[model samples]
Target: PEKRKIISRFGAFHGSTIMGAALSGLPHMHKSFNLPPLPVIFAARPFHYLDGLPGEAEHDYATRLAQELEALILAEGPETIAAMIAEPVMGAGGVLVPPEGYFPKVQAVLRKYDILMLSDEVVCGFGRTGNWFGSQTFGMEPDMLSVAKGLSSGHLPIGGVIISDKVYQCVADEAHKVGVFGHGFTYSGHPVTAAVAAEAIRIYREIDLVSQARRLGDYLHAALADALNDHTLVGEVRGRGFIAGIQIVEDRATRRAFAPELRIGTDVERRCREHGVMIRNMGDVLAICPPYVIAPKEIDYMVDGIRAALDETAAEHLRTGQLA
Candidate 1:
């Protein structure tokens, strides 16, 4: 009998555990680590900003990705594949938002192959993606889900997996035969953490944070576009809701990245800090993930700092004769 394997994508981050690390596709997470325990396969990242082909429409790009997934499944023999996991909006991997119709098409392919779809909602969950969950925002119905980060609003460490009835039934049936579940966390049901998480959920519903995130997301997008869309060094500004990424490039027309040696992202982030704001960068992509309670003025302040930093960085590059 052949064992099944899990499929993930490049630039994707799952977690820091043994198996989760194996499932992650980011090299920094895997460098010198002996992992994957031999059953994880990586697929192409669904990042349109960097991966989309010139002259290709979003739908077309999504179709190509679906076809590639199907091809991979067949090559590996569908029976030998178990499930595919993905971040509805990839975080830690450049905040890549998938092209329209991407998840739905990928779901169809998985269904045809009898493969489960696992949604990694660690970053995109709890109002970050303008919804309670990214699955709903992007039109996907996952077989299983892993959620964290905002569950307890970071007051305490907690995460959980939600399984569909089918998966639950399988595990239950097997456990009945074995007379033991065979797995659990030491802090599985710590009362204090559970109580805090419960209150967090209650607050989320009471305050309607999801709706606020949606409204603010629209404002943030518009502000970012208005401020940076025409910037010569900004190749792309893309994201959803509270999560966003700004791609800095040497040449916007060609999307040519500044040489890694320049450390443009680090400098830009440092400059933003000097202006009283802080942003994280992965290579040349600057990330903006503000608190949910942030006000409109704060959003403007954040963007203003970023704009000033970009100008400063550009000036430095010119001074160093790295630009014309």
Candidate 2:
């Protein structure tokens, strides 16, 4: 049998196409659609802030997750498993960054089972995490990784996959047998999109984009910590480089979140827009992924606006007696 089972994680958002939707593990992405489950198995999300055991060390948590993955692969039969796909820093999963040693442990598990590791770099690619790819920052040795969004800096929309030499050899051998690989979408390589992506790469090289993102990322995370780390409603502020996530909670002590009807994330997003910053809100997590070229002043403005939004939202809850 062809290797078919691929491992993804809960709270993941791979893409919106049929196969991508099947790859995704979020309900919102599957809204209004009745698609059957593909051969994708969902593993645990690396949400240490929420899911970590009380007082558990980060390294131990990573080991536990790796053991869990191994259990899945064993039960499913490793030979039937093709690859385990993951975002280096889970973007749609509220920018969830795994425990410090998580990827290496997970990669070890994959190696034990002879399963491939695939990095979904759509959101964390191209200096988002202060590196050319989040995989580099996190030390994930992926057999293949997908790239988009930053490929053309959202200017024209293009994506490509890079494969390891082993995978390439297999592909080349198969293509030799068939004359050419017959895998593609109608717009697989639109000339204009390719040109735009090429230009984006050139500009990135010209400006030393990676180092710039690394420096600015440090400042952005520091600013966010200074502003919101101790806020009453903020459960967590996390990210690297130009990306971040603010976890909102009704009670910071127990990490209790507001009810779904509150739409607290959406309110923060609206307020942020009013104050001239844009944030992507997914339920209670407010995500910020500013452009790599953002100045320190812009980071300040964005963080300030989010703080105000949280304050306003908290005040409303207080008035309604939903918060104490």
Candidate 3:
């Protein structure tokens, strides 16, 4: 088998185990263990809210990114490139959503080069993105789909890859040649976890959870937009379905981020926790990914909590000379 390159986006959080951490693009994970041993290539993440240039339309941004990908593959030699992995919504990477036409264009580039496309749906699968899978939401048809997180609704630890027929057949033939398949975790197919996942799938289908997530996601987005859009420190509000992010900045007009020493996101997160709400903060962005079972009232509460936290943090900043 020829060596293959695995291309990943910056700030992505695939996992924390050795190989998983290496695959992750966030520097925090690498601080403890220098990683990405040899095969991984880092690429720019398509976060429209933060990285899209001024006056650039979403479609153009996507096109430019796709072209950049093609250039990278050519430079690295496509034959050596094994796969390009991505999250349809870029979850732990601050809920970074791709610009319009981004996934489709990237998929086209991958196909042109015959490189495998791996959709890492760990955080965007199973109704989190208003669809059964983020690939459906983003129009990506991948060779392999890695799913986790909502697979069991956080009820159990389980993850697996859905390999396409072509890849499956190749692996099968290769295994026969080698007399062993040779790749599996100790708990790769644990029955208990599978049973929990089975039940979770049943509930999602029985209740039409995908549609519900879509509906509630709309409510969540509107509520957050209404509450935080005008805040002085909010740079942008972006996300899909139940997963969303409010990017905090020192200058909202210029989208200038606050100093790292300020730790504004941390303060906001602490305040949200004080208000009985949990939110994940990445740099200056505050992310909210509530459970699918939450009701409209709970949605209101979540928004209110975020609002209160932001307001309080802003007030504190003003008092301390951190904000003008």
Candidate 4:
């Protein structure tokens, strides 16, 4: 049977295409684009910070998420589901880093239902996630992994899919029977892009940037925790490696996000830029994804800038009587 339904999680940002938008669970993208309706199922995101229940341990949270996934797959009829696509670290969806055992348990459920696990490594690939791929960082054994963005280190736009031997064999046999495999884009194999990507891969190995990201990530996370964990507006500080998010909240004790109209995230982002650092905000969560080559002093500078920006933004709000 041709399994056409692919499962995604809430808050995921795959891309901006008809098919990609359909696979993504963000409502703004879907409504704005008038995305073509496609067969896509949504499962709960394993965001421990926001999604985990009170008194729930990390492993327990993982177990609960896995159970929810199993339930979703069963309800949808596992056979009809072709694949479950995920990012090792949820980037645009608020830098959601899954619990320690989350991926392994989720993969076990997918295996029982004969569903393929697809890893979208566009953001977490090429040393951004402290590993060659986020799959390695998170213990995900994906049947196929899609990577881009970091392939040419954002120097060239080239994306590709890596498939396991079993899947490749099936595809090869099908193409053989059909006499021609009709697929892919005109820029798929452009020599310039290929050359640039190849050189980038070589540089990654030569400098061992993955290890550097891992080491620097520890510094970044720790610095962020020390500086902002006790702040009134900070609800959570979470992430791994170079990809991270700082959740801004109206009520820190309750972890209630600031309303979109307040534009807290955008305001903080502007403040960071004014302080000589640039970051993006998804609603009230500020995302930080720095270069793999960033030095310790640079990390300090960026984190410091963010701290100052937060303070400035808070002061401005207080002065204007906008903060409650």
lDDT string for model 3 (27-61, tens) is 88888775656688888899777788899999999
lDDT against the true structure, per candidate, is: 0.90, 0.90, 0.89, 0.90
TM-score of 3: 0.97
The residue-level lDDT of candidate 3 at 50 comes to 72
Q: Show pairs that collide, candidate 3.
A: 5-82
**Clash count, candidate 1:** 0
Best candidate, lDDT-wise?
1
Please give the distance, in angstroms, between residue 165's alpha carbon in candidate 4 and its true position after superposition. 0.8
Worst 10 residues of 1 by lDDT: 29-38
**Which ranges of candidate 2 are over 4 A from the true structure?**
none
Which ranges in model 4 have alpha carbons more than 4 Å from their true place? none
- Worst 10-residue lDDT window for candidate 4 reads 28-37
lDDT of 4 by residue, 1-324 (tens): 768899999989899888888878788888777666799989988888878899899999999999999999889888799999999998888899999799999999999999999999999998887888999999999999999999999898999999999889989999999998878897879999999999999998898888888899999999999999988789889988888899998888788877788899899999999989989878878999988778989889999999998998888888888777
TM-score for all predictions?
0.98, 0.97, 0.97, 0.97
Query: Model 1: per-residue lDDT, tens digit, 1-324?
Result: 263799999989998788888888999778887664668998899877778899888899999999999999999999999999999998888889999999999999999988999999989999999999999899999999998779999999999999999999999999999999999989998899989999999999999999989988988898999999999889999998778899998998888888898888999989999999989989889999888889999999999999999999889989989865
What is the alpha-carbon lDDT for the whole of candidate 2?
0.90
Supply the global lDDT for candidate 3. Answer: 0.89
lDDT for residue 235 in candidate 3, whole number 0-100: 84
